[model samples]
Target: MNFISFLLFSALYTCLASRLGDRTLPELSASGITTLITTPDPIKNVDPSNPASHLSKILIPRVSDTENNTIVRDYIVSTLKALQWHVEIDEFTDKTPIGTKRFRNIIATKDPTASRRVILAAHYDSKYSATYPDDQFVGATDSAAPCAMMLDVAEALNPLLDERKKRLDEGLEDDEDVADTTLQLVFFDGEEAFVVWTATDSIYGARHLADKWASTYLSPHGKRRLMGTQSTELTGIEHLILLDLLGAPQPSLRSYFLDTAWLFDALVSVERRLGESGAFAYGEEQGMAPEKWTTYFQPRTELKINMGYIGDDHVPFLERGVPVLHLIADPFPPVWHTLKDDATALDIPTMRRWNLMLRVLMSEYLHLRPEDAQPHSAVRRDASEL
Candidate 1:
């Protein structure tokens, strides 16, 4: 997609979506400084908060501080359980003659019986080192923000789930327009490569899952076409939405067209609609504006994403033919990866709004029954308050 298309699609929201662009997409706000991310409130033990708590996990002092896969897995499992989801720990030993690293993909499902699935995913593992300073960057924005957002959604969605189950049992017909999408929250490890910039180092977890998925649904056939309503204890998969470094001060959610189609459009449309509809930004603590973006992209409208191609966890699902949508944005965000990338750069209001947007979108697309949405909505906090 070209920059113009990105601008135009957004312009469609003449009053709310597009109007902000001209005013918001100015030259620059802050100097592009290399900074480190400060560690914020650590994940403390809260049994009533998340059933995933029963799994025995430790919220590392920092993201990069994660020394091994075990800590990361425990955190994923415990956090999801606290959200009250049946957990599936998918593992693949990357042991090859070239060598292998142990990787695990944590998937906690709140309503697996739902007809279809909508996945909310982000990488929990941190890059081992940084190129800028002696500090090992704690990826609060890169992945943590998205992760925390997912956690927040889990908390708030819990109550939504109960409502869905009741309606379904009462024989609510499809005509009544109930969402039956099963919600899957996945935390991927091995997303960061051993070598920082090497194409291989970037997205190990997503690629591995794609390869495994292709083998599962396509090997029997000539090619894999990621589709179907079929569900499994550990098989059948479909669409996915990937979240990355979105917690920056004012993340510009520029829709990217250079990659997958259905997925990206659905996500961007969901984000904008929710924003304009005010469901995502409801009862704002301070009425924070949408994330401000850079004017580097073309200003047009069409069915395409922004020219910004990102290296994030969504690439794998797209490769697997799952039509994954990526929330990767433009200008790489100022606090991308520097010792200056601390929590100080984080904005709780923006994070909370995004969490609400994701919850609503996931429910809309994934068929996450209103009830299932709740069983996991506790993850969202008052952004303005934070």
Candidate 2:
């Protein structure tokens, strides 16, 4: 991600943020949050020391257009596919500063038949380096941990999503419109520029995907979001929550858009509940214990437009009028873009907290009942029906 002067584009972003309608997410029950956190073993996938973990698999020099990029893309695809998600690979070639290169963005939806979707996304590709050792930059906090946390959210909530589907099918769901919205995870490729950050050089996959979705018209049957008007894939999105620069300790996050401020506050609520419940107290990280943990989100003061915006994959989507919640570290970790951004830069307790936070946040966002989900089952299918 790159930084731009907030003064240069504050008005433009404020206008875009206002285009989004207000959204209210149901809060998960204490037991539900506990079930979601404990069942999936929140620390498993994000643990860098575990060779079989998702982070370990993704912690490599996966520069876009390279073999490592393909490997990481395939890994993400297979993981989502194992959970029976509808996965689509947006493959294309675009001109870069260096030359034309191939980019594939992974789009995984829990229920492709849903009318609308809320996206959780992060970039899977690492920064490109010209030298050998420099090329080994893994981008652990840059995005690898965020990607892993996305996977963890999927695993933790898959059963609850199934239960929600069952309720909807049985006509027992409270709100059909809310139940119609599904979860979609997007792993954007080429988010990192080949050279310095430039409008054309950065976020190649996002720019392409956003443009494609904007133009790809959906049939009237699925255009229920816009009062029977013709809608495109982009219009079917309720909100796009983009995660970046996570997995590091002591990092601060802020609400970048007025439209998603409620959603950001919703996430802060999840963290607060989990912290007070002692869920973040992992091993020796006593500071994260109940009443001792610090907040990742800064306090929201005046209810005004944001002062600036960060240049990331969400830019194209937000410019196209998508409600965006950009959850990126404000200060950029101390190891930003350096060779030191390997596994050493990631803190397990921090990643675990992120995992739990996503599980509860998404569970509440989707109105899923994690209380109905059981732990350790192959797919939580053996649990009592919702």
Candidate 3:
């Protein structure tokens, strides 16, 4: 992912963002959020110090087409597969400035048969460097951290997703269509440019996948709830939330598109609740205690804001009319594209906060009911406000 001039495409994105509809998601009750935060401990998988943790597994020099890349990709695949997700290794070859290179995009779906899905995506490949020391760049925050967080989210929410499915099976779910929407995690490869950042070089995996899915039509089935006349894989996506440049301290995220502004706000609300509830407080310092924690998201104002989108994997799908919520840090981290972007660059507390936030956010969006370890009495915040 590289930065390009946002002026030329601002109007186009503004139009697309305006045309897309916002989803009104059910907010999790306080107990439900607590259950998600503590059930399995959100920090377990993202801890950089834990050698067997997901983040530690992915923190390697995994440039596209390299052995390290395959190792990281396989780890992601095996982790999701262990949870019984339907995993697809989208392998392909694309011509690059260097030469023809292989790329594999991991597509893991919790329920592939579902008519529609909400996607969480990130590029798993690190930027390639020729020199020995430079070649060691792991891109810890660039995406490794985000990938680990996705795994944590999957592990934390898998049971709740199962429960939602059981409820739908028993006809206890109020909205069958919404209940049918599944969670899909996409780990795109070949996101970095081989040479200079160009239209043909950057985001090779995303471009290929988007074009393929756009043309590949889905066959009709009785279980498909709202199939349009020409329903394709691309069309089946409810939204694509892409994570990039995360896992760093003091990262500032903003709403990049109007279509997903409400969705972004929903995430902000989750963070606020978690922060105020002291869910972010960790370690002996207790740095993220209720009053001490700061927000990662920049609040959206009533005034129309059109900050042109950053050039990333989501650009391909966004161009194809997919609603996107890009959760990338603005003003790229200081260690970005440097050898310093290793395990040390990642802040475990920040990653833990992200893990908790995703668990609560995705849980509520999917209408998942987490079994409360300790029940609390409070009014439900499931009212559709967005």
Candidate 4:
């Protein structure tokens, strides 16, 4: 009640408030703030044909073939591990038309500490045709090239990701709550149907993984939280970008969802810039026009056209409310699901263009800086960053 007592209480309250504010609003390190560089200039000199360059190593009879599944799985696992990524296998058995079949989803992450993720996915399975049981279909453009392209992107971004991880480990970055934007690569098995294209027959790995992720939760202490906890949310996935039928010549890619149209346009812009830099000229020998390198979903005319829904590996994620950017050819390549869809179906020039476009798009998305200037900073945790 005395004046001295009142002054003491006031001083204590002020000190407590100051400490709480310091804890909540800690000063961010300079390394934590990302600097946006010039957009899609194609200044970096990279091999244009790198995306399809791995086809020879990956092109196989059928990903679903019992004898070839392990080989394909081993290739994927070893490729990711060689890039220093943390890889995990999601193995499960599913009931199919033929019988009980085992499927595996190879999940790779660059940063394990980051809660939010950008998923780059492709199905590694080739279709099975009962009519041509003895035929060996390579499905090069259908999915083999797409899977290889995903690996190319992962390999390109590995250095930046490793640097960010180092900064986090050394305490050079002060962000604990909001880590950098991390990349998650998913190689789904059984995307192709054993019989007919039914809801249950295809995308077995994607369906299982999506369900599992939706039910899983992380606690504040980094432990597995209960599924029904009120505070739990789907914090792992931010955006899902699915690549398919990407190695065909003069392929057309259109924006699938209204939400991810901006991303599609971004890719178009990247293609245009790369064209200006003569990147697409590499395709001239193969009869691809450099002027037509842009994506099919141009804002002025093509934006209004709806290409309808596609049933790829992203279906389960999209159905569960996760944003998806389906990077598949609109009309389905001519050789799709045919015996002719082998290594010869892939166009080297088209693969080159796709490789450059993907590199620029990913660098822009992750705010990657030049290796000589400074190590790329972690993406800020703000919504605008997404």
Candidate with more favorable, higher lDDT: 3 or 4:
3
Q: What's the residue-level lDDT of 292 in candidate 3?
A: 92
Q: Write the per-residue lDDT of candidate 1 for residues 103-140, one digit (tens) a residue.
A: 77777888765544557798877655534246666665
Please report, in order, the local distance difference test score of every candidate based on alpha carbons: 0.50, 0.85, 0.83, 0.64
Off by over 4 Å in 2: 7-20, 303-305, 376-386
Q: Say which candidate scores most in lDDT.
A: 2
Candidate 1: segments with Cα more than 4 A from true spot = 1-69, 95-99, 130-134, 175-180, 217-238, 258-308, 366-386
Model 4 TM-score, all chains together: 0.76
**TM-score, each model?**
0.65, 0.93, 0.91, 0.76
lDDT of 2: 0.85
Total backbone clashes of model 2? 0
Better TM-score candidate (2, 4): 2
**Per-residue CA lDDT of candidate 3, range 334-380, in tens?**
98988888888888888888999888889888888885333322211
* Collision count of model 1: 65
Task: List the lowest-lDDT window of 10 residues for candidate 3.
Answer: 377-386
Top model by TM-score, which number?
Answer: 2
Q: What is the lDDT of residue 116 in candidate 4?
A: 62
Candidate 4 lDDT over residue span 99-130, tens digit each: 89888888998876565677888988777767
In candidate 2, which residue pairs get closer than 3 Å at backbone N, Cα or C atoms, i.e. clash? none
Q: Which of candidates 1 and 3 reaches a greater lDDT? A: 3
> For residues 1-386, what per-residue lDDT tens digits would candidate 2 score against the true structure?
78876543444443334544666778777777778788878888999999888898899999998888888887888787778889999999999988999999999999998878999999999999878453588999889999999988888888788888888889888786766699999999999988889999899999999999989998876426553366789878888999999998878998877778899889988888899989999998899999899999889866434767799999899888788989999899999999899998998999989998888888888888887775556332211221
